[model samples]
Target: MAARPDKLVIAISSRALFNLGESHRVFEEQGLQAFSRYQIERENDVLEKGDAFPLVEKLLKINELLGGEPRVEVILLSRNSADTGLRVFNSIEYYGLDITRAAFCNGESPYRYIGPFGCNLFLSADGVDVRRALDQGVAAATLVAGDSRKRRDDVLRFAFDGDAVIFSDEAERIYKREGLVAFTKAERASAQKPLGGGPFKGFLEALQKLQAEFELDSCPIRTALVTARSAPAHERVIRTLRAWDIRVDESVFLGGLPKGEFLRAFGADVFFDDQPAQCASAAEHVATGHVPHGIANVDA
Candidate 1:
């Protein structure tokens, strides 16, 4: 396994930091009645009256679960132009969370690029922006959790789909483009052969390095592949993984079934795929992410 990085970097969108209910409650409790398009737009004004407490609590809890004291960096991006760091800081102090550092970026737009720094997770309250970022190559958003040492790296399981995730999406594209007949014929012929490259090729290599660095026996990172392609298509998946020398703790070929049940049973920390329907359901059950297939029009 490769050496584990000393710290994990996380850039969190402001809305993602606060739970939906908490944010809404904060707006109402402050009595900041200004509304825009029938939604509260002046909630930021209430921060001076202590409406940012919930957001702070949520941040502290996230820091706790991620391991306290220099383990994580929380970068908050807000849509409000006013500075809310002082209130956010006071809330962190009140919660007694050991946050090594924190930063806030204020603007009317919540969308921002936060990558190229090797952040393990990039979270946003706006699902649309999250999707766009994933399509643009930023995968793995952090899951919101309460501050607790028990959940820190507790069975850090990662789940992924077989097609497109580990193997190239070529076969799936053929199926989609030319229909099932050609796809099946191609799969049968490629049985002993391996699929082409995948979106997670580098990530897989990193995980292998991580596994070796931590020692596979007591490794904190575990991986699973849950795909809908079964039987004949399974061989290529196995061969591809073997050729890459990457170890997957669990692999399930569900053969065209919804992956929600399996993902829930696996208790994955994050699951990645290229399909929205799959991600939409998986996100309801776990910390799910979408990895855009390069073959497709990423900009589209």
Candidate 2:
């Protein structure tokens, strides 16, 4: 096989890739046997779209522009057994999704295989798996179920959090430990210094490379920085991106304002944040991914 070191590989869980809420509830309430039977019975039924559906669909479409040689690859990484995964594969076929690779760990953590898969990003509904993936230096996000906004096929919009996502969690740790005043002072003091890179930095860099394939006016990918930090805190983020030579088409400094309406107006295909509350809020308006990183995710 030829080398594909540059391919953007994305591994997704069955639950995050499809709408399996009822089946999941059955598994939790009854037992694995009952859940397996339910899935087997509904094997022919096409599953509904999940939180990451739009994003995945768009990513797959990016291959079409390259004569279908597949610059992007999507893999199924789920906790279900191979037999139980038949329903997932059936749905994938029903939807005509171009996915041919999968790993059904049968309840074991699939994150351990992320490195072997060379996944640029991992998306799942399981928080524990996401946190573990981040800890292992892989970019992963917990997919929060949400209502998808109207998507523009010609343009794909992505909104990301500032701290603990695109930038390092240093500022976030200070904020979590100290009060707002200390965090603000620290950001202002380090305004000239570039912030450290976080988990999603490589993914953003890859997207930037993809963006370069088209003109600015005609670029298919549009990225935004939608963060809660305002004014002085924003300087560090700007300088950080400048130092890294990354392009952000839009930026919203909310200053603690709710992000749902803003994300709706941006018509984002997906949004990512480190905080659970922010993800829940964004989920109300658009598909949201919870980046489980930094002090915000530390267990008590």
Candidate 3:
């Protein structure tokens, strides 16, 4: 067996892995029994691709560049029970994905198993599950609808939010409870202290390790920090990344500006943010993931 030192493990849910909007609608409108029956009836039907499918396919293809060493592993962590999950497995086999591990949680949140699997990232359509995973200090995102662009076989670009998505939400909590003034003061006062790691820290580390394997000019991955923090608040973010030794190719501190246009211009493969408003806006131009974490999602 190949060594697993540099492996990047991603856990994905059924709905995020494939286009199950119709089936999900059935489940929402009717009930679990109807949904199970529907899935069983359409067991052989190949599911259409969803937003995260292209990203997963591309990540898996990266292994081919590594001489088939299997540097990436994608696990299916779904809320569907084993009986109703046959359709998803069949679809995976039909697509020829190299995914062999899976967990059918029936109605439970699959995030509970992410830690046990040592997954670097988790993508799901369930907001609650994503939030739970984030609270548990795991890198997780709730995938939302986005522009259905065809997948490219070139470089992969990842865009991440600042608070709660990449770094901890301490400043975000202050910002939420107080206001921008108090938040800025808090950040400036603590400029020297590196903020705590957020849910996506582990995933970033994995990608950084992968990036190190290749030369800078020829690296297949590029990362960006697209945050709403600006000026004085930006100092803390820079120090935090520097402290972590993570390389960010691009940094855009928008200072509360709309991020949709910038994300569109960047041509990101996927954008992850904690705020739903930003995710909804970015989804207009590019694929977006909602990280339901930190103070922004405390009420939700």
Candidate 4:
């Protein structure tokens, strides 16, 4: 294992940090050699910002607010070899991102490096890599190139789905096996039992650590739990959060309504959900990441 830093470390792919769609297309259609030549030919050209650029920008801004103490660190994990990755570094310098550490995996999935880097969260354009990270019990999200509109840069807001994201898919499995009526009954009966922690649990805890650095009223970070749960189902989620001792600034129980408009209203920087439908909706409003885990992803 690599040295784990005490800071809140975030691991992001090069494609997530910058727009690499053109070059990625080259790799997909042509192959690695063509992609390598293409990148080398344009090594000096600065890449445009990707969907996650705004979110990454705001996350790094936290360090600036802390007087350069760098309580948060973002790492670059890419499939590009060092030789072909010069353009990425060049663009990073051009954007003036504070990121300094990276792992050039040379066309390999970079998920293996997550533990060594002590990543509280990992985001990637590649769904395969994201799934691999989640399999290792790391909080990972597949970044969706949604609206890409930049929001207020001062406060970084995050939203998450309850089951299969913040909590285990146990309840989700029950819901799948049994009908909604039975699932609701089961939840109501076991309301006192704390649901198992999901992948993003550690990441949320890390955010709490960072939040501790500032006053609650002034903290620039906000989190929300937006779920399809309503009425009796909401109690279990509330009790589960209480049991875990985690703090979410806002908890919206959508109870099967579309979440995009609500997420837009919340001014979320990024929203995480296991359901593609929910993610697609949220992406229309803000940056969204698909957590391909649990029952929703059993066949996925």
What is the lDDT of every predicted structure here? 0.57, 0.87, 0.86, 0.90
The estimated TM-scores of all candidates read 0.66, 0.94, 0.92, 0.97
Model number with the top lDDT:
4
Which of the numbered candidates is closest to the native, going by highest TM-score?
4
- Estimate, for each residue in 74-138, the C-alpha lDDT of model 4 and write its tens digit: 99999999999999999999999988999998899889999888888999999999989988878
- Model 2: which ten-residue window has the lowest total lDDT? 1-10
Local accuracy of candidate 2 as per-residue lDDT tens digits, 1-300: 211356878889999989999999998999888998998888888898787877888888778775546778999999889988899999899888899999999868898888888888889999899888887777789888778754756577889998999989999999989979999999999999999999999888878877787677877789999999999899989989999999899999999999999998888988999999999888999989999788888761
Candidates arranged by TM-score, highest first: 4, 2, 3, 1
> Where does model 3 exceed 4 Å of error?
1-5
Q: Please identify which of the two predictions, 3 or 4, would achieve the higher TM-score against the true structure.
A: 4
In the predicted model 2, the residue pairs found to clash are none
User: Which segments of model 1 are wrong by more than 4 Å?
Assistant: 1-8, 20-82, 85-103, 108-113, 131-136, 140-153, 191-197, 292-300
Candidate 3 residue 154 Cα shift, in angstroms, is 2.6
Q: What ordering of candidates by lDDT runs from best to worst?
A: 4, 2, 3, 1
Residue-wise C-alpha lDDT for candidate 1, range 233-285, written one tens digit per residue: 78878887887777789999987898877987886766777776677777676
- Candidate 1 at residue 50, lDDT? 23
| Candidate 2: stretches off by over 4 Å | 1-5, 150-152
